[model samples]
Each structure stands twice: as structure tokens, then as C-alpha cells.
Target chain A: MKGAVERVLRPEEIPQACDDLMKAGARLQMTYAWFPEPGQSVEVAYLAVTAPHEPFLFLRCSLPADSPHLQSLAPQIPLLGWYEREIQELCGVIFDGHPEPRPLVLHEGAHPSMPPLDPRYQPDEMMPFTSEPWDRPPVEGDDVQTLPFGPVRADVLESAQIFFYYIGEAILHCHPRLFFKHRGMEKRFEGTSPSLGVVLAERISGVDSIAHSLAYCQAIEAACGCEIPERARYLRTVLAELERLYNHLHYFGHLCHTTTLKVGEAQGKLLAEQSKQINGMLTGNRFLRGILKPGGLRRDLDLSTLPEMLNRLQPEITTYLRSMEETNSHLDRLITTGHLPLQTAYDQGATGPVKRASGIGRDLRGDHPYAAYDRLTMNIPVRTEGDAHARVQIRMEEIHESLSLIARAAKDIPEGPVSSEISYVSGGEGLGWCEGARGSTYYCVHLDDAGLLARVKIKSPSFSNWRVFPLTVHDTNMMDYAINEASFGLTMAGCDR
Target chain B: MPVWTLYGIRRGIATTSWPKKDGAVAQPEVLGLPRYHADRCRDNCRACADVCLPGALSFESCQTGERLALDYGKCIGCQLCTEACPNDALTKSNDWAFGVRNRDDLIWAEALKSPPAEEVTRKIQKYFGRSLHIRHVDAGSCNGCESELQALNNPYYNLHRLGIFFTPSPRFADLLLVTGPVTYAMQGPLRETYNAMPEPRWVMAMGTCAVSGGASGGGYSCGHGVEEFLPVDIYVPGCPPNPAAMIHALLLLLNRASQHVQGGQVAH
Candidate 1:
């Protein structure tokens, strides 16, 4: 509200405005929807982060129902390519002249003929995994051959198909087929009471449960016009930073693991285990689920062991990551592999550590500043290399910053009621966001008149960052694939959902 | 290089001595399955079942009266049923040691009896008694289960210490440990993986999602669980069962331990 200027434009005006806005230094966070009645019309929203000036530009427009289309922004905003395709598949809205309009979320034959968002759509009794809607983009070289990996992979947690058209050790072209983990998460959110939908939001991504729930709660809080207690915000800052600390430690460790660094992987797991255990001490669940409601978190800070756990966390991370940094054999594997240029990072809408490591001095925590970020110094470590090494370095730097932030917030959390009072009526729409470990995670909440969630569009940071995966693999040899993939730290579930 | 190696060595072994030592991972208020006391349920009570999102708790018409049915497989340990139960019929407990031999051990309030222990085929015990290799399939989990699964390898849990390891290849694996609600798209791959495992292979449902579809059960593009498609040897219940809980489940599978909490013990 402080710096953002909202505009309601017609379909015809969007291209001109978006074109001008991009030129004026506004970067697209995500383009999402709150469309209830599909055939009549649809309202598409563009959330742009206009840095060094107004924090955001909330541009929205309603396209006519008959055509159910708008001029494609895919060409201008290359990041919009997947976002547009997702809307087409998930919401059934076609963007006229979109570049790659083939379905994004669903495997081609995973669903029935009807679009998922259609009111009358019924799932087939037998959803056989038949054939893909489209083929992997063909690599046109005599020596190049296609080798497809996954939907199921070795030693990996989530599911996504990576088609590498390569020649021996040189990766020529890579195409990623995701949504093997899509459970129609947005579709699942519909019809559930907004109050109860927090469970759905919490499970959207396991590791980022707190941030996801906060984003959902904030949107509902915005609808209710409720201001949470100061104590609650500080508590949120503590847990969210804790989430970031463990995830980074896990990522850094896994990056080491790709090089067959046994001790590195074990240390990473050890630090991550500490984070999860501490989370269990603070909240009931290890994953920090069920900690938030629309008004505030369901529980308060467990201060009995807070000081002790924080003390343990800081040194473990410092000792482990610092030692790993000094290990040259490890550095030899990471430094030059998977280098991403700043231009490609911007053009593909790469986000989080991947973008930050490429010397893009932009972070939602420092730019838009949500939760308790404004009260913090918010030091974001930046690097120009944009390689596997930079990603690890950036994460290590943030872990140190996060540890201190948790300590400061724990000390400063005021004595006050954590929950708030809010009337839960419907016919409301609002945006909720957090600077999750991966990047800026956004949730667009729209509640219908009956207090039912009409639509909840979650744009996970992984959704944008996953776009850069294929591009990054081209930088390093094929042997570094595992290291490169883990370095990215993108979640298949979050991206697919 | 020597510095990191020395740091690791000086750090000493971080492994937990669980099964050897008394519980090391349990914390106060850490959630597991709800302990049900049928005697405490009020007459005509269906409150707990109503708030049960995954249909984990439900009532059925019986000649005696409406009877409560608790399916541990469907339960995500949300504790909503425990909170909603007016008579304290369902109470909170940290007794997460819920790895059982039979699928029927997961369902309760049906004549209030545990599944016969004989349901675990003797062949499985003979084949995997001392050592076991597991091939994990993420049928359709939220990645929460995977997080815990990864932790099993870390120094703290050190699953390998117990003679259990996660094999990347199914051909070499003896047990197929599956997580998630078993989405439709993954059904084919899941069946293929199970089929590839050599004979005497066992299926272990790792989380409530794979156990009984958890919260996202009965949705479009999802099967309620792996049990529907394949015979499961064990059921471990949690939103994503913790590392300790999962270890207990695996041990129980190999007959290394016994089930501790009895079904339907009415509180005094």
C-alpha cells in the first residue's frame, strides 16, 4: 500500500501498460487469476515488483468470456510462457498467440478430455497414463540422441521427467516434463471453507509449510481487514527464518553430495535434522504444519529451549558450511559448473538463490519486505558467477544472517496475544506472499459469498525457478547433472502443484 | 581436503543409539496417531468423525447402535478428531510406534480388536530377517515424507546402522516403501516397480497419505492408497511419519520389535 499503485485496465490496454511497466523497471513476479465463472469472463492479475521505487504494481484486467482470450505477453515477458500455459491447462483460459500453448501442469494423457477448471468436468474412472500431449522438443543433430530420465529417478525425492538430448558427455538440449506430482492442488482448494483450507495450503509444500500457510492466512487476513498482534508477526519471522536455515543447509549439503562428498552430505543432513528437531520442540509437527490460522499461529513460541537450540544451530551451520567452503576439492567440482548469466536469469524470470547468485540485488524480503523483515537489516548475499559455487555461497551467507535474525526476533517478540479478531465473511479477494527459502511464494485467495474458497492460486517460487533448470545444465558437463540439479534446490511437488 | 575430513572425524559419530538406547527422538507434544477410548464416547456422538477431514473417523449404523470406526491409514495425525471429541474418546498421545504387520492392524473400532499377528507371512520374515534393502516410491506425497526419508540417512537416524538401506534400483530391493496418496498418473509406474522387485518383496506404507490417502484422499487424479493396488505388509501413520517412527516401522517389519500400544484401551 505504501508504494504500490493499482490500475484496472481493459484487455486492449494491458499490452501497452505491461510493455511500458517492464521498460520502467517492473519485473513480473507472477500472472495469476481469480476466475470463478469461466465462460462469461475472467480476471487475470499481474503482480510486478517495481524495485527501487514503488514496491509493487498490481495490474488487473477482465477479458471477455466469449473469446476468453487476451493478447499474449509471452514474447515480451518470457517468464509468462509457462504461466500462460498453466492458466490454459488448469483454468482453461487461452492466451491468444501464446508461444508454447501445449499443456504445462498435466501430463498429456493424465486427464480426461475436459479442462480441470470446467464446472462440469468429471475425472475418468480409469486415468491411465497413456501418452504425452506433445513430444519432447526434438534435437536436430546427427550425433545427438535422446535419453529420458524420470517421472521416476534414482536417489531423488520428487517426480519430473528430464529429457536430455545429448552426445556422450555434452548436453545438447534438455526438456523438463513436470506435474507428475500435481494433485490438482488449486482444484482441491475449491469448495473447502476458507478457515479449514489452511490445511491444504500447509501441505502445498512440506518444507515451506510455514511460509505457505502464512501467505494463505495473510490473504484471508487481508479479506477480513484484520491486523495480527505484533507478537504473532515476530513469532512468524522466527519460524520462517528457521525454515530457511534448514532448507539452505540441506541444499548446501546436497550440492556437496553430488560430488560424492560423504561427510558433506552427512553434515548437511545433521544440520537439517537439528532444524527439524528444533521445529518439533517449538511446534507440534516436525514440518511446522498446523502453526498458522487466518488470525495468527495456532501456538506460541516454546522459549524453554529456544536460547539453547539457537545456540546449537548457529555454530553447527558455521562449522559445517565454513569448512566445506575451505575444502578446495569440493570447490573444484562446484565453481564453474552450471553458470547462469544475469540476462538469462532475468529473461527466464529465474528467482530466489539462482537469481540472487547471478548478482540480481532483488529480494522480496528487502524489496517488498513482508512479516518482520522491515524490522530487520535483511542482508542478502549476492554473487556474479551464477554458478553452482555461487548458489552454495549465497545460501551459506543467508544461513548466517538467518541465525542472527532468529535470535534478534526471539529477544524482541513482545508480550501480547498472538491471535486477532476478524469477521469471516465472503466476497473477498486479496494477495498473500512471503520470501520463502526458494524465493517469493505467492497465494491469491478469493472467497465467494458463502465464505467458501472459490479459488486459491499458489505460485510457488519453484514454479519460476524451474524454468531455468534446462538452461543451467547446458553450462556444465553431463557428469555434473546430479550436483547441478540439487544445486537448483527446486521442488517437483511445489512446481507441479 | 584433510581439514574437512578432520573436522568430520573430530566431530565424532553423530549416530543415535535407538532400539539400543531408550527413545532418543520423542519430544513432548510431537503428534502421532490418536489413542481411542471407546468407553468415553458419549451416546449418539459423531462429533469427532464429523471434523475428521480424511474420513479417518466415521460412524456406521449397527444393530447395537452407531459404532465409531477409526482407520489409522486415513489419519494424518491432524488431531482435529482429538480436539473435536467432546467426551475425550480420542485422546492425544506421542505413541508413534505404529508399524504393524497387517493392513487390518491400521483399522480400529471394528469389534475393537487388533489384526491377527499371523497376517504377516512367515516367508517375509525368513527372507528379510537380518538385512533388508528398500526401494522407495513417492506415489504422490507432499515431499514431507521424502524429507523424513532423507533424514533417515543422516548421522542422527543413520538407518543403515540397523541393516536397512534405500536402494536406487528395485531389482536389488527387498521392500517397496511407498509414500503419498498414490496419484493416478503414478499408478502405472508404482505397479511396474512392485512387479520388478524379486519374490518375497514387501510393501511398506510410509505415511498416512500412502497408508490411507491422508488428507488428499478420494480426490480426482488420486487413488486412496497403495494398499488398493498392492498388498501392504506394514502401515506407518503420521502426516509424514517422523524418522524415529519410520525406523520403528521398518524394525517391526523385520520382526526386530513388537507393537507397543494396544488398540482401544479405555482411559480410567
Candidate 2:
């Protein structure tokens, strides 16, 4: 409700209502869940003011599914284009005047009228829609040239499909279509208990396992009305910061690797390894799984291990940072490689490093204090360059900040039971948001009478960041694609889930 | 100009003569899977089995107490079961070389080889003599293995000094390190990778998913396990197998290869 305004409207008034909203300088952010019964269907649309510091508005409309149609919000809010397309694809609701009605989340062969997120939707029973085989469109022009890079690239990392079009030296167009390793995680979550749901969330992204799990746990905890112990809160914050550190370090190493700076890559790897070691010391698993339960933390941080953890990490971090400085080529290669204008970052609603690089000071850890974050001092790093170098510097600065926060948390370690006892409550909806390594991860949980998870909607940070990639890669050569991608560190698993 | 080389030399012999010298596990955190004590088993309790992601633990209950059977063949070294056990019955061990020739030989907990310290030390010393070259082929992994694999070269793990190195060309490789369940998309690439390797080259399926298609195998496009597509000499299981276990598997392969090269019957 911070920047959100409220409004109520009838089903027939949606088209003109949206028009009025547009005239009032408001744009559709996204449409939330649609409640559909035997004959009637009601949908909620959220609209926000386009300008900074403007309020958001929510409009509700009830219509019949047989002839369900709404006025398109694309002309007013360009960002809503993808969201609207997704709604039409999944909900089987038509946007009468929309530009494109193609599916966003589903594959080419998915059923056109199949309700994707609806409780009745069954993967095995229903026939999936099939389309003509998709082949990359060829470039047509004397100057224009098409350059296809991967499904297989030199990175020796993750797999992705990318095609870049160049008009001489400058890039004309770039399209990145993923789903090389889509595991159908969302479908798998059906019929799964909340306890098992935590595992799925953690596995969504290996690097951001703790963050995703924490978000899912928060949702369940909120629904159950579970008040986590203060010690558990501190431990959660510590783990989240540790996850952030390692992820940033890994990204830094990747950036160096792409830039062909061997020494810098080596130093970055050392830092990342140290962070992983620290994670393992804190929790038995290096990825920090099972440390978080629905109510609170699963295990208490052993005070005896603190000294050893600090002794192993602190000196190595300092030495690695110094060694990183010795390699000037790493910084040089990343300086102006992939630049996104400040406006583009804001327009795309970019979060984490992408936003920070563009000098947009938005960090959920500082803005919305959750857990032990309220007790700690938060520093938001910003750079106007908005290039690969700026992103790396922002990460490096954050890594230093995180180390300090970890030190502080460890020093002021509280004494208490790590978890609080809680019972189940039925018929409640709870929203939980956490600042994951990538950005803000939001989880919405709806519980049944038995306190089991009836429905869970997870919006990972990658969902928000993926849009910015195409925009940033605009006009840049194909070779610089890896550098830009490495800087962003987008996780396909998290997005697909 | 020579400063880098001088620094490299200054950090001399960072590589451990692992199997020979009982190479110190730089990070004890990632040693291996937790060992369960059967004496502490409770009546009708399958907590460990229930929590296990890899389906490694199986519980059979009588009137008095339940007998839990752990199959290392299925275990991913997740250690979730260890944490879930209410009693202090489960604990992790430092035994890294759990590789074997046969499917039954790979079962760690059942066989539970706890060799004497001196013997382990001698084995380590003997294994550290020859460098084992590895060729890594990612059969549609989530990049978790790639990240962890990259970490092996860091100063802390420094796998290069352990007589373990990742070869660029498959022809020179003694081991074909495969990560992830063989996906339909990567099937051709993976098969090509195996064919490119030398005749005596062993295949180490690294991770539970790679060994048995982890979690992603139940769906379409996933090709179950590497063994279905190609012969697997060893299976180092984990969600993404820890770098230590990966190194251990490589060393074990080198030992087997060395025996094979010496005109001796390589033990399965």
C-alpha cells in the first residue's frame, strides 16, 4: 500500500476504466489472481503511476469465462505487454485490442485454451497445443548480418539459446530465447506438501538456494502466524548475507573469465571458494539448505565455530582483494562493454546490481527491514556508468559490506532456542518477500483448512531481471554478450520455476 | 614481467600429493556423507528415510526398533537425513575414496570400509605418484557442478597439485567426468565426448542426478542416467558432487588406470 491506490469497478467498465487510468497518468503493473467458479470469473488488475513516487491502483472486474475479454493495457504501460500476454495465454482470457497474444511462459506445444495455474489444470490428462516448428528468422538486408552464438558456447557453464543481428559493427537486434533446461518445477509443486515445497524452492536456483527457501518459509510462517525467535532471525540474515557474498564473488569471477583476465579470475575464484567454505562452516551444506524451516531455523549456530570461521576467511579476503587490484586488465575489459542507460534501467524495473549500476538506490534489505536487517546498518552502492565494470564494482563493494555485517552479527550473537513452536491455522493468505542475491523474491501462500499449502505463487528476482537483458544487449556486438550476461548473473531455473 | 612467475614459484607445491600423503582435506565441511548408528534407531521411525532426497535410506520395522538400510548407490551425500535424526546416531566421515568397479562395490555405508590410518596413508602416497587427466562433459547440468568444478582449482582446493587436471582434449583423458542427467538435447554431445576419449578412459558420473537423473529425470527430455547412455566406471553422487569427492574419484580412477597400464588385472 506504500505506493498503491485502490479503486473498484464493474466488469463492463474495465476497458474505459483502464483508459481513465491511463489519462490519470497511471499504468497497469500487473493482474493478480483470477477467482473463477462454475459460471462467473472475477479478475483483479493492479495499476501504478508511471512517474516516481506515484501511487498504485487496484481495479476488480467480474466477467463470464465463455466470452472473457478486457481492454488491453499495453498502449498505456509498455511493461504490461509481457504480463498481459502471459495472462491471456494461461487464463484463456482475451485482450481484445492487444498487439500480440502469444504465450510467454508455456512452450510452443502447450494447449492454447489450457488454464496453466488453475487448480483443475492437469499436465498428463490434457493435450498440449502444438505449433509450427520455430526456426530463427533470417536477417534480410545488404548491411544486416545474423550471428548465432549458442546453445553451446565457450563458457562451459549453463546452456542458453541466443541470436544476435548486426548491421556492420553495431548490433541491430538481439533475441535470447531460453528453456534449454526447463525442469517443469511449477507443475511438480502440485500435490506437494509445504515441507517438500521448501526443497523445490531451494533447488530452483543453486546459488540462491537459501534466499529462495527463506522466501518460501516466510510465506508459510506468515500463514501459520509463526513468530520466529530473535536468534533465528539473526541466523537467517547471516545466511542470506553469506549467500549474497558467494553469489557476487562467483559473478565477479565469471566476469573476469569472460574478459580473459586470468589473474583476476583466479582471485575471484579464491574469494568465492572462501565464501563457500564459510557457508559450509556455518551450516553443514555448502548451499545452506535445511538451515531454514517453516517456523524458524533448523539448527543453532555453534558459538565455538565462530573464531575458526573468521580466522579462515578474513585474512584470505583481504589478500584476494589486493591481488585483484594487481590485475588492471580485468577492470579495463569490463569498463564500457555492456552499457544500459539510466532511464532503461528504471523503465525495466531492474533490481539488484543492474539497478545499482544505473544509480537507482533501491535495496529491499535497507528499504523494507525484515528479520535482523532492522538491527543492522545497510549500505547501498551506486554507479552511473551502468556497465559491466560498474556492476562488478558494486558487487565487490557489497561483498565487503556483507563481511562487515556478518562480523557484527557473529559478535552480537544472541542466546535462545533457534525455533518457535507453532500450530496451524486455516483459510489465510500471506505474502512474504525477501532480498535474494539477484533481487527481491516474492512468495504468496494460500492455506487450506488442514493448514496445507493450497496454492503458492512465487515471483523470483530473475522474472523481473530477464526483461532488462534484451534491452541492455541492444546494439552491442555478439562477443560482448557473455560479459553482459555474466554481470547480470540471471538464473534460468529460478525464472522457469 | 617475471613477478607473476616468481609469485607462482613462491606459492610452490600448493598441490597435495593426496592419496600418497593423506592430503589434508582443506575444508572438513565437505568431507563426505554422514554415517548412521543403528543402535540409536527408534521404534517405527523412518525420519531419515522420509527426509532423504535421493531415496538412499530404507527402513524396516519390527516390534522393538526399526532397521534402517542405507544404499550409497542412491545417496547424494546431501546429509539432510543426518540433521533430521533426533538422536546423535548419524555423523559424517572423512573417507573420500568410495569409488568402485561394480555397482555393489560402490555401496559405501553397507561395505563401510574403515581402513587403518597407516594403510590409508600408504594408499594416498601410492595414488599421488601419477597425474590423472580428466575430460569434463556437461550433459545438461544446472551449472551447479560447473561452479563447484571451477572451485576445485581455487587456492584452497587446488586440484591441479593432487595429480588431477581437466584435459581440454578427450583423447588424452583417463576419465570422462559427466555431470547432470543425460538430456535429449545433450545426448549427441555426450556420446560424442565419450567416443572421443581413449579406450581405457573411465566415466565418473558426478552427482545423484547424473547417476540416476536426480530430480529432473522424471520429466520429459531427461535421459535418466549416464549409464543408460554410456558405461559408467564410477559414480560420485551428490546434488552437485563436492569438489573433494570429485578429486577422490579422479585419484581412484588414476590408481585403477595405473594398474591397467602396468599389465595387471584392474580390480572392479
Candidate 3:
């Protein structure tokens, strides 16, 4: 919020502006559409970062509500394809000259009169689902057959359909039809008070509970020009790191399962459960929910017992990781599986661990430095392998980093007020970002006339990573598909939301 | 010996003897579903209902004027109501095991009595008392429910130890454990999974979402729980019910454990 610069541009100037930004080495972070005034005009904003630790640049273009049209930027910028497709489907904004423009969140049979995101739109009785084929790249060979995986996959996985063109073990092409879990999350945030909005944000992705709520709360805090107390900032950092620990451990366990290391998987999961138990002890909830509010924390946390608990769990995690590293079978499966090249990851706009693993050292914790992150010493883990092994190693290193961060935060936390009273500023817009367990989570909030939320656009890390994930899956074997996916630690809820 | 096996052996047994040994819990610090004390409610006090995001608590207009309708099935266990309550009507408790065979039992009502043990329970006990194969379908959960479901097979919970296993195929499954708010896209797949199951298969709604469409239920994409789409036999309601609660629900369906909750009240 402090360093973000905004510019209002003409609809015709978007393509040039995007080209200039791309030439300037700016990476597109988020693209979203909102109604400035009800039934009047549609405003589309593109947010990007030019350099590490630089202020975010926002380019806003307005289109008439009746005929909202914009020249497509997706052709030049591959990462903007999904964002453009989403805006096209949800806000009814047509991007002229877009390639392969298909419905992203909405499945084939869902036919709403106006876009479902439009305020005047009325939802039908039942949301229809049909197996209608979209434009998928043809893989035509007598041996190459198209196999449809699921909306209901095996085990306790999220609902998503994936199409794989394969010949024996070789994967020819990969297409993921996600968003089966789309709960209209952005629409649910409409007209809600900031406090209630936090509750909704926490549910957007249950795994990234702290990150989503933190970003949303930061956005509202920024809009209100509210600064939290020192203690609250440190505690926020602590909670986020705790979330990272559990998530990474869980991811490690799942990755092990995919590699067929049953014992390793069990051990990793048991450690994760212990980490969650520690979280439950710190906060009353296991998922670290119900504590984050707009101003700061809902309640003051007790850190007297945190250091000892974290210290005890830290050694177990070290041993677990060391053991995992030592497992040749596990290491062999991950070493070169799901190889995503550096150029592909960069071009596709990968974020969080995915980008970090691809040698991009752009961690929001160090670059942006929100919530006591600036106060602490930040050491980012980066790998250039751009494979499953690199991703796993990144998470492993991050777990250690998170533990150290929490320890340092707990030790140096200053005693003060945890929260500050927020005065809602009508028509205030703010953008907030945080480095989540998976990736950098962004939230841009616009307040309505009455100082309530008008439109909340969430750029979940998974939304970016999911877009970039299929790139790694292509040309990969069928045997390592699940392993590759597990190593990435992608969640459908985050993507769908 | 393999390093993993040795490492596991060194850690010793971490599994809790819950439902097997009395007073044993998975996590002691974690708070469960909010307990509603109807007698302590003040007249015209809708503090709990106002903050209830999922409409778990609401004032229902009954014959005797408006009465507070409390449904644990829709509760995500956020405990906002307990904090907002001026009087101690809604209190926080460790009532994590809220699994019930009867759907109506989750809705709170004064003097609501539990019906006698059904003949169906005995039949289920006869069929799946020893070993139960479960096929889980994630309707449209936030992966919170999936996280907990995955925890059931972990070293601590060890669901397979209790003879309850998550089978990959529905053909061999004795129970279809469904989670999430039953999103529209998932209804077809869910029905197909249920239909594919063998005869005498039971449906257990695993979380608040599956029970009564947690927070995202009745939204544009998803319906209110699995009950709307399928005949649910057991309703376990937590935001994402802890691993222990899921085990209790499975055991309850098999008539291995007695129902602890009746009319949303935890029996001592």
C-alpha cells in the first residue's frame, strides 16, 4: 500500500502499457475486473512488480458497462491468459483477439443470463454439469489415447478433472480442468464488513488459512490507514510460519506416499500432526483460524509456551527431513521428475516455492516485508533445478527457515497493544501481499460508498502455480505424474476459490 | 533393519487409545463444537445468531413466537457466537465427538429425546462390525476436511487399526464417506460413486459442509450439504471434524459406539 503506484489508462492503451511493463522486466501479479459504479462502468486493473523489493505498479482501464471490451494481452503474455479468461467469464468482459477463450471456473452446462459475478444476475435452481469438450490440443496417434482422470479422484483429494494424452508410460499432453470447488468466494466477500470478510477469507483455502486472512486483513488495514502494534506484527509472522511448517510437512508426507515410501510418508504425516497440535495449543483452533481480524488479532496470543514447544518439535522435523533426504528411492523419484524449465516458469508467472525453486529469488517476505518480516533476518531458499527434487528441497529448507523465524519472533517480540481500532475509509482501495506456504497471496480490496467491501479480488498463489503446473506435467511420464503433482503441493481449493 | 522402520521404532507408539480407552483425546487443546444451553438464553438475545455465518444459529418463528434454532450440523466451530453471547448461553466445550446416526439429533431443541436404538444399527453391526471399507468423495470441500480425512490413516489415528480402511474403489467399499458442501460439478460424480458401491452401503456426511453446507453452502455453486442430494445415514459436524470425530462417526455407524449427542446436546 505504501509504495504501490496507480495509473488510469484508456482501454486502447492496455496492450502498449503491458508491452512496456514486460520490456521493463515487470512480472504480472494479478488481473481483475470490478464495477466502479453499479450498472455504469467496468474497471479492469492489472498489478505487476518491476523489480525485487520494488513498489507494485497498478494500471487501471475503464470500459462502458454495456459494451465492455479490451484488446487481449494474453497472446503476448502467456501468464495473463488465465486471468483474462477468468475476467471474460465472470465479469462478462470480452478480450478481443484472445486465443482459446474458454470458461475457466464455470463448467460446460452452467448458463447464467448475465455473468454470475454481475450484481443483477440471479442464480438458477441447480448448477448444471455436463461433459462438454472444450478446445484441447489434439494428440492424434493410434497409440496415444486420452484418459480422463477425475472430478472425484482417489483418496481424500480435491475435485478436479485432468485429461492426459499418453502412450504407455509417456505423457504426450496434459490439460487440467479445475475449479470444480469454486464456491463463488469473491462474490461472497461483497458487501461484508471487514471483520466478517476475514472469516470468509480464512475459508477461501483452508490450507492457506493464515495467509489468505492475513492478506485480506492487511488490505483492509491499509484502506483504513491502520497500523498494528509491534506484538501483533510479530505474532502474525509466528502464525504464518506455523502454517508453513504444517503445510510443508504435510506436503513432504504426501510426496513420500507418491514415491511409495510408506514408512517415510507416515513419519512425515505424524510430524505434521504434531505441528498442528502445537498450533492448536497456541491458538484454540488447529488450522490457526478464528484469531485473525482486520486491525490485528481477535485475541492476544500466549507466547510463554511457544518457544519450548517449537524447540521440541524442531529436532523431530530435522531428523525427518534428513531421513527423507537419505532415502534413495524417494530421492530418485523426485530428482528429475516434472522438470519445469527456468524460462517456462518465468514466462508463465510462477510464484511462491515454484518460482523460488526455479532460481527466482523473489520472496515477498524479503522483497515486500509485511508483518514484522522487515524486523527479522530473512534468508530465502532458492534452487535452479526446476524439478520435483528442487521443489521438495525448497520446502525442506523453508521448514527450517520458518522454525528459525518463529523462534526469533518469539524471542524478540515487544510487549504492546496487539490491535488498533480501524476507521473505515469509504472508496479506499488497497493492495496487500504475503508469502504463503505455497506462494505469494495477494488481495486487492475496494471499499463501497458506505465503507463496506465493494469488490475483493484475491490472487491466490495456487491460482498462479496451478496455471504454471501443467507445463511441468507435459512430456513427463505417467508413473511420475502423481509424484510430480505431490512435490508441487498444489491444492484445488485454492485454485477453485 | 531399514532406517525408516528403525526411526519409527525409536519414536515409540504415538497412537492414542481413543474410543478404545476412555478419556483419551487426539488433541487436548483444540476446541470443538459450541454447546448451546437453552435455559440460559435471555429473551430477544440474538447475539449468537447474528454472528453465525453459516446460519447454524437463527431465530425460527414457531407457534410459541420466535424460538432460537440451533443446528450443529451447519456449525463450523468458529466460536464467534460464544464470544458474542452476552449471557453464557453458548459455551465452548471439548465436544469434538458430535457424530450422530440420526440427522435430527444435531438440531437443538429442549426436551428432545433420543429414539431407541434402531433395528438398522443392528443390521449394520452384523454386516460391517468387523471390517468396513470406505470410499471417500470430496464434493467441494476447502481441503480442510480432506486434511483431516487423510489424518485418519496417519500413525496416530491409524484408522486401519480399527478395521476401517479407505478403499480406492467403490465396488469394494461398504460406506461412502462424503465431505464438502456438495458442489454442483461434483453431484454427478458423487451419485456415480454412490451407485457404484455394493449393496448395504451407507452414506456418512463427514463435515459441517457435507452435513448442512458449511460456510460456502447454498452459495451460487454448491448446495446445502449432501442430505439434499443423497440419503445420509450419519452426520458428523465440525468445521472439518478432527480425525477422532471421523473415527467416532464411522464407529457409530457400525454400532460400535453409542451416540453422545442428542438434539445437539452432549450427554454426560
Chain B TM-score per candidate, please.
Answer: 0.91, 0.73, 0.96
lDDT tens digits, residue span A48-67, model 2:
43443333355666667677
Q: lDDT: which is higher, 2 or 3? A: 3
Assess candidate 1 and give its lDDT: 0.79
For every candidate, what is the interface RMSD in angstroms?
2.2, 4.0, 1.9
Number of clashes recorded per candidate: 1, 12, 1
Question: For model 2, how does the per-residue alpha-carbon lDDT over B107-135 read when each residue is reduced to its tens digit?
Answer: 42434343312343245346445767777
lDDT of 3 by residue, A1-497 (tens): 33388888999998899899999899888799998775889999999998877789999999999999998888889899999999998899999999867778888877656776776554323445566656566779898888999877888788888999998889989999898888887887777777788888999889899999999999998888999988999999999999999999999889889998888888889988988889888998889999999899988999999989888888888988998889888898899888888888988889889898999888999988999999999789899999899998899999999999999999999998899999889888888888999998999999988998888999998989999998898888999899989988888899888
Worst 10 residues of 3 chain A by lDDT: A120-129
Off by over 4 Å in 2: A1-132, A135-138, A167-170, A303-328, B1-17, B38-43, B58-80, B83-142, B161-177, B181-203, B219-224, B227-231, B254-268
Cand. 3 Cα-lDDT: 0.87
Name the 10 consecutive residues with the lowest summed lDDT in model 2 chain B. B257-266
For candidate 1, the per-residue lDDT at A83 reads 85
Ranking by lDDT: 3, 1, 2
Model 1: pairs clashing at backbone N, Cα or C within 3 Å: A40-A65
TM-score: model 3 vs. ground truth: 0.98
Where model 3 places Cα greater than 4 Å from the true spot, the runs are: A1-3, A123-135, B62-65, B114-117
Off by over 4 Å in 1: A1-5, A52-55, A64-66, A111-113, A119-129, A132-134, B26-29, B43-47, B63-67, B119-121, B261-268
Write down the worst ten-residue block by lDDT for model 1 chain B. Answer: B259-268
DockQ (Cα-based) per candidate? 0.56, 0.24, 0.67
